[model samples]
Target chain A: MLKMTFARKVIAAAACAAALIAPAQAEEKTYRLKLAETWPTNFGTFSEPAREMAKLAEEMSNGRLQITIDTANKHKSPLGVFDMVRAGQYDLGHSASYYWKGKVPNTLYFTTMPFGMTAVEQYGWFYYGGGMELMQKVYEPLGLISVPGGNTGVQMGGWFRKEINSVEDLQGLKMRIPGFAGEVLAKLGASPTNIPPGELYTSLERGTIDALEWIGPAMDLRMGFHKIAPYYYTGWHEPATELQFLINKRTMDKLPEDLQKILLTAMKVSAYDMTINSHHVSAENWVTMTDEYPNIQVKSFPPEVMGAIKQANDELLEEAAAADPLAKEILTSQADYLKQIRVWTDIADRAYLNSMAE
Target chain B: MLKMTFARKVIAAAACAAALIAPAQAEEKTYRLKLAETWPTNFGTFSEPAREMAKLAEEMSNGRLQITIDTANKHKSPLGVFDMVRAGQYDLGHSASYYWKGKVPNTLYFTTMPFGMTAVEQYGWFYYGGGMELMQKVYEPLGLISVPGGNTGVQMGGWFRKEINSVEDLQGLKMRIPGFAGEVLAKLGASPTNIPPGELYTSLERGTIDALEWIGPAMDLRMGFHKIAPYYYTGWHEPATELQFLINKRTMDKLPEDLQKILLTAMKVSAYDMTINSHHVSAENWVTMTDEYPNIQVKSFPPEVMGAIKQANDELLEEAAAADPLAKEILTSQADYLKQIRVWTDIADRAYLNSMAE
Candidate 1:
């Protein structure tokens, strides 16, 4: 394992020096890369990108760029993907960037913000709007290269047992939510609790937790949350929940340019593919959920309730921005971009959708 | 070109057979494929996917696959891409599927419909909802394999010199809108015209055309239509205009497995990349357009006007469906997929965006 770190990566390069050395093609070494995913086995679309990327990398490189992925069931530490990749134990990692927010404060901004841009909007920001640069600034110091892995469009606000009609309804509400969204709920006087996936259905089915926000209809349908919680609220907290792909800087430096390109392209293409798959599955599952359970109601918070939550979110973001320069920079960039792009989105997608609605 | 058609595609297959055949590695061949694009050179994001795909394919295969593209200006055949690729004059082509409607009647359904799905929804329809299979059914008999090239979100409803408040206002309106959209307008007593892009600004300026719909802000801003047309309307006609990559059946069959994988991955990834780039450019360009011309009024057709247009669109579609079984199948598939998916989209993205709006 130690020797293989620098032992592989003999790519079939151009026709110059290698052709001169021998009449026949030169011997090429196959580089095998190991990936660690934060999800367990059969984690649905959340688990698709890593598997698809690895398969594509291998096939494109003709077995030259072999990649094997180990899910969290094998790795045993869902949150330790960053450490394992950075320590060079694994060549790559598939995880959400927000998971590292406790360690790296700026990591929270890379994943979806409370009221940030949607998937495509954030994708534009990442590739064309200086997001990749800012992301590298946050990850480069950790000796890692982080890129977008996948997106879950817009997450459902949560499965609420009771309606949130006003600001006062949020007080002392107990829900199973995580990350900065939980903090926003905390600011609004809700008790945000983190529970394991295996325990969520049981917890929600019983009186242990009043509500829970998993992914969208895709994963949540299987959890049977709709059967227990009748009111499914629309999203506000995390509009575009994007996962991250992390690679060790040392591992990246060891590969030939062609192999490097192959790996990066595989990751990106798979990321987009997974996003489309996520949308497909969510749309399919939403229909299945609604059909199987006709009594389930989809609701949105009243404007006053939303306004209050937005205010709390704004204040929390302001305080975070004030405490750190990087936070302020990321927040400002996102805010300005959202303000500009949302107008076009409103005029383009929103208007079309509204005008066409029956 | 004839020598190179079957001359390349000698992939480094596997170790056992290849190593036994030759003591050293065997020499690989570089496959050069020629592509014809509908757009002329420097046609903005429309020209990006082919170039980016060619670059990625070459890099990933280490120059094993090389693709060269000829623009409409070079070939003097903007609408001849489908013919060129099918006739084996070109191995691949970059153009919209709707451009081939004059040649293949069913080709119109693959690009977009009058009032169809948005970018992501259309993408879902293509990848996950049997759109590719239906597309293949349309193109397979023509000796071509067509895949999505890129998308330009929601196309604006063109720049208008005069406001259209009622259905009566569309009487004899000379609008430079092409494709099935023009047919939809023609049903509404409007004189639909097709002007050369180079002469579009002059035509609108001199009253040769009263209004024109080219694309979104990205391409529109450079055309300077806003300087003359003060009423900028939101889209109703062509939603999610997806470009296409047309590969000759012989061309696809000739490539080695690895090279084929590389080429396909590059095409898919570049398609998604260009979609993101389109969104970025439109957002940036929208800001610039409004900033430079503050008098631009962004409006949507009143409900009555939209209803009339939609009625005309539906009538045309119903006639098309009644005429052909393949057309009915494709249209039914899209309508069903859109019906199911739009509910989730309304609840997820539309709800989220509306809640976030100030």
Candidate 2:
């Protein structure tokens, strides 16, 4: 019995040493996630966040977290991203939240309202303010999580052949503006149409459409719209068009805590990266446009015109609030936040820009 | 021989099973690092980036990369951060890069400059334009790695007891402004003084100082400057002041790849987070200040005053450029980038803000 006890002690000691000797990597598991992005392959800034996030996640986790991304061209479903992510067909999704508004009405407020808060203000609302919590409240029940993917900072109002000097000019104005802004403009007697991207340039040039609001210079410069439409109006709608990143809750829960942190941190940093990239790209592209086509005239709608558009927007928002409690809650939160935050913006950013403008 | 072989197999199997059964965490080693920050303990936005970065590194690495921070109060070295990190006394540091300009003259360009870019534009420069490479060119040779820590969005010009209507108004005016900005004002005949923060309120109140610029409303509101100084001028200097994170190169190299990535990602995300946080804090604080003291007036230096200050600034920059080749490279990069980017800002953000303003 004494001999057996001594042998047992030796075996236990050997086993403990063996456990310590085993390489840490051998015992750890690698987690693989699949991401589906709304942008087509090589979609420039729009396609960068997910690709960068995936790369960061992989590198940060030392290849422990591997993410594979499929662009819209591969999936043939840019707008179907929300459904795919929610149903667990895709572990992650990169798209806009408002694209899901047809299925989930409250999703509309999460992207950008006609005259909503700008990128930094909206980001402030998301991370520090109550925006993240509110966003979660909408996505949690759907078994998905959504985060701010990227920002297209203050999209241009549109490229117009003729100046919009008054609200009267908007009557029977055929323009290519989509979604909520289009709805708002529709109320102002402008005929808003959603033509596919390929047809936009010719339509505007041939008078099928008088104006079109593509993205800012980053994406729009490639479309050659500045050549045809010389009057470039500044933004009122889609002030800060923040794209959305969607995660399947089950897939997220499956990751180890370290990998989870790596994934989330990557998402956040990449989102911020894309915001800066958008600004950089637009800045570069704008210079190119101005250098080649010096005839481009920058214009803002007159106050009466702006006031009328804003009134129509407010009325639409009121109707949205009346229809749903969740929508009202989000709209109220944004309105209250915008009211408080815009004062500082006026005092800090606006005052600084105006003072320094040439 | 057969009996001996079976006994050996049993022992080997037991060892392998034990190795598999042992906890994964126990075998991993925790790498601890110490960070020293220039800000005193509990300093609001200035101190938050390092604290948040440390927290994130720990959480993301699952207690593997543990960082302990020593604030200015604890270490008694507010300005000695660069020296401490370089000498390996502290593995990490949180401070502004411009703080080290006395030691490394080229370091002044990284934080902010008079009439430079705004927060988003500067962010665009840092991450997208060649700013990061240029920044590293100044830091890498010193055995330290630096990354952006945080940003204070467009600092207010200052709180003045009286308005500056012309260049003559700045003559002999005692103001609490520091760094290159002080030099610019000094060249313009203003007396720029560096007063201790605690004494600033008394100094301004008793006419010991004519005006002072601490920060935006976020920090300024708590100092009770609003009640005393009625004319709050908008910023012309330190637009998008970027704080910096420093790491000892040896310490960074010693870290495992995963831990290295974890630390960097934490630094980046926390930096961006603080930028949003600054905006949020200022917005909230601005509201508080207005509610309590509606007498505070937001003002800007007049065109003649601004023109003089800008001329002084340009002359000083020219001198710095002539003195150092590296300074020339950095200045040229910033000037060229700003020239391109500010045009986009005018068309997008400025136009949007101006159009929407009441």
Candidate 3:
């Protein structure tokens, strides 16, 4: 009887140990996160970073971190990603920072500005310069963590029915441009208007708009704008248009240390990958566009017109800076960084390219 | 007595399950990897990718992955990284692909080629335009897996004691330039010689060589070459000098699926990060160089000189292609890719830069 009693006690002790360790192990439970992206389903490279991030995070965490992405089509709100993520409707969002400019005025600076740094130079500022801190200052107040999502190397100026020979050509020109760039065009006496994406083609085709600025060749080729526009102008505004990833601070804080690192690294790598992919797709599509439509003329606005556009951009920047102290600080930082970096760029890449041309 | 027996049976069953699970858990044992780098300790941006990759891999794997790095100083073989990694003396190596040209002539094409694509374009070629397949064809036969380690965006031609006015100026000019670029210069009647990095500065200072080609401002600033040399020439030799990460196929195959993904993601992200960081450092260092030494003149070789150099490079490439079927295949692919992509580059980035210059 005593032996039986001892066996019973031993079994109980073993049960207790199992109880202790099982839950500890179970603490490695799978975390399911919902991400919302601004781009609709199958929106080319714009939708890539979110999916790539989710896959990487899940793999790196051994299936512990599972992220499901909802495109704008499913969510029925293309521009609502910021609010959705902020209100806890989604844990994360992938969108352009400039998309939130209407809600948060300071958010505009995080994306490319008019005639801003190129992709490499802007990345330098974001990582090495004070761009990240400045970005954090703007986001932390809203309970958000923002990171570089992707970069469109250099956006094209626009597709034009008419070649812009001088500043006078822009006067009273009906163009479809949006956001701050549109505002800059407005300052130059051009009638810059925003149209729905679906309506853009019709507008350009029917002479409703004289010109339209869209994304570069990668995304634009599918839109079929190259079929209508004969003159493709080079970019001046929106030089390095960087998309952004936004995370709810609370959600990020809740993750385990390793999972958190996985998530962060995944986001970072996906962002960089998207940048490279964009360049690749653009090169591929550009070849296709030219091969099929051999008459598509590439043009850059003359120096006189470019100088006028620059002046307008500078004035608007000044006004924005004067209005807000943070804006001033951010603008000043970007300007100082650009001034210092451009010298090197001129000496290195620019000189090299020019030499090759010679 | 019946109740006690039932409880005992349950405990025994639980114990059996735990035993079954524990070995599966034990499979998550930590993996320690040693890596050898071609660069010495504290070798600036060149040493960053390996350390960054190791950190990311460990964090992502929840401490399952740990990597330690040894520089050339410790390994006593800067040029032996390839052999060491191949022999499993080190699990991994960080070096440039071109370093193995003498041993494996086919390894030369993985790094940047003269007059080839720029950084962004080359990355495009690697990921999307079939560069990766070509690289794998070379490395897989040797039981190695190689990935882009990092990039020095564009290397400046060299610092010169006198201006290179024409093709004639290169005649009898002794310069410290190695690899394929040296061969090109030698074809143009320049006496191109290889020297130890430690001895380069003294040689240039003491007139042992009239000029020397090193890395760009990011690395060159530390060497203080601008202090002695007056002319800083633009690059033609290496447009995008991509460093390489070599892994033993057996070592990689031994890793778990999730760990393998973590390792790959870590390497890829670290490589991209280094590219951005190099640009940042170069911009920072260039500022320092010019601020102190105001008289340092930036020049591009005359068109006549560049033309002669191009012809020599083309002939050497032709000979390389004639030597091996794989070499011919790679050269053709690169040429074809460059031809297609350069159009997009011209329309997008190059056009934008020129417009801004105007």
- Candidate with best lDDT: 2
- Tens digit of lDDT per residue, candidate 1, span A1-358? 2132222223333322344444323334568899999998999999999999998888887777778899999989999999999999999999999999888999999989888899999999999988999999999999999999999999999999998898888899999998888889899899999998889988988879989899898778888898889999999988998999999999999987778999999999888988888888999999899889999999999999889888889999999999999999999998988888888889898888888885
Clashes of each: 1, 0, 0
- Model 3, B1-358: lDDT tens digits are 2343344345544544664454222323578899999999999999999999999888777677889999999999999999999999999999999999999999999999889888888988998889999999999999999999989998999999999998999999999999999999999999999999999999999999999999999999999999999999988899999999999999999987778889988998899889888888988998899899999999999888898999999999999999899999999999999888877777777777777776
Alpha carbon deviation, residue B23, candidate 1 (Å):
14
Q: Per-candidate DockQ versus the true complex?
A: 0.46, 0.44, 0.42
Backbone clash pairs for candidate 3 read none
Off by over 4 Å in 1: A1-26, B1-26
What C-alpha lDDT, on a 0 to 100 scale, does residue B233 get in candidate 3?
A: 93
For model 1, the docking class works out as acceptable
Docking class of 3: acceptable
Alpha carbon deviation, residue B282, candidate 2 (Å): 0.5
CA shift of B145, model 2, Å: 0.7
